[model samples]
Target: MRGSPPLPREFRLVPGRTFVDASVLVRLFDDDEPVRQAAARALVGDLNGPALVVSGPVLAEFAETVMVRLARPLAPVAVRRALTELSELTVVSADASLVLAAADTAEEEELGLRDALTLEAAVLGGCDRLATEAMRHGTVLRGIHVEDPAFGGNE
Candidate 1:
């Protein structure tokens, strides 16, 4: 992914770059939660690269959830197509720096490693917000605000 200079810290109050978590992505194809499905669709309807950020771990989680955890699992080809369609969004790769940062966040936030990785990915990707259903609304981790976009929270 191309690197963009981090925005000034004060820009946090504004809606800028957003990191999407797997929880929201999985809702896109989940027929069981129609309200959330609609909200998820609306949140991502117009988002594109640069403004939208996602990480490798998040994508993998999404793929796994859709394949094995969903009530109606998608075929491999369908999942492949979905992933391909997401190519427009910026994707962050997990690395040594990311792992170390996540480890620190895990201890500091009392979050699991996977959740910490998602938070750290948002910071490393220069995101001002993180949209997910996995964390409490309004929780801030390392300068990124985590919210559940499908509910009553920031997108």
Candidate 2:
């Protein structure tokens, strides 16, 4: 799933880093859809802005999808390296608090557990923006701003 304009190394992200979802994450490496991949590249490689934030669960979900690609599964070492590379962003671990908050988010937002988990992770990470293709673009989740970077929205 590796590609040019690759996920950066040693990138530093502050608390306000925009949270990134797995939808964009997968595109950044997989080349599944060229249009989406370009969008992901544009968003991630926008050097003038802060690096997007990501979390443990987000990377895990991304990994699960990438490891079982229809063409060929990623090697374990590649998966491990990808996870490590993703951790360069501001990442909140999926711990007891996050899971509990996700439960609440699911109940309140009427979202599935995975979606709720993604949103809750953004909130807990102190992010003000969420970059994803999952939600209605530009809709705010409570106070967190949500947008689809794939559609040219800047996080």
Candidate 3:
């Protein structure tokens, strides 16, 4: 019998490091898109140990996108289960400070509202790296580093 296969490099989940963005989470269930597939694979491969961090805004966005854009409606029971799983991961609440920071980043970096929110969440969570494929390289939003695992570069 074969032993369990090795995990992906991106899924290591290093403790006290690396903040996860909604893009990565959305991909896990989005098989129709190529980018999503890559993101899902990376997370499953390298992020088994570290705490996956997200914000209230991220969760809301995920729910809306999955239900509306994807036209995939999850039952209320399933939604609750998903929330429970997300709670086990690191979820940062959106306080006044976080909102202000996100707003500022959005203005300075010209990022969309959702992207700005994600950036703020990553910073508030003390994440050294923000994993995403949404933004381009060298895109600095209040000093929070945006990284794309699939592309293997920092934004």
Worst 10 residues of 2 by lDDT: 1-10
Best by TM-score: 1
Better of 1 and 2 by TM-score: 1
TM-score of each: 0.87, 0.80, 0.74
> What C-alpha lDDT values do all the predictions have?
0.82, 0.74, 0.66
> Cα lDDT for residue 136, model 3?
71
Q: What is the C-alpha RMSD of each candidate to the true structure, in Å?
A: 4.8, 9.0, 10.9
Per-residue lDDT of candidate 2, residues 21-44 (tens digit): 998888877655889889887877
**What C-alpha lDDT, on a 0 to 100 scale, does residue 100 get in candidate 3?**
70
| Runs off by more than 4 Å, candidate 2 | 1-16, 47-50, 70-72
**Candidate 3 on 1-155: residue-level lDDT in tens?**
21223334553434346667666666666767777567656764665434567778778776666666664666667666766777677777887766776777777778887788787677667666777778774455555566776766442
Whole-model lDDT, model 3:
0.66
Query: Weakest 10 consecutive residues, lDDT, candidate 1?
Result: 1-10
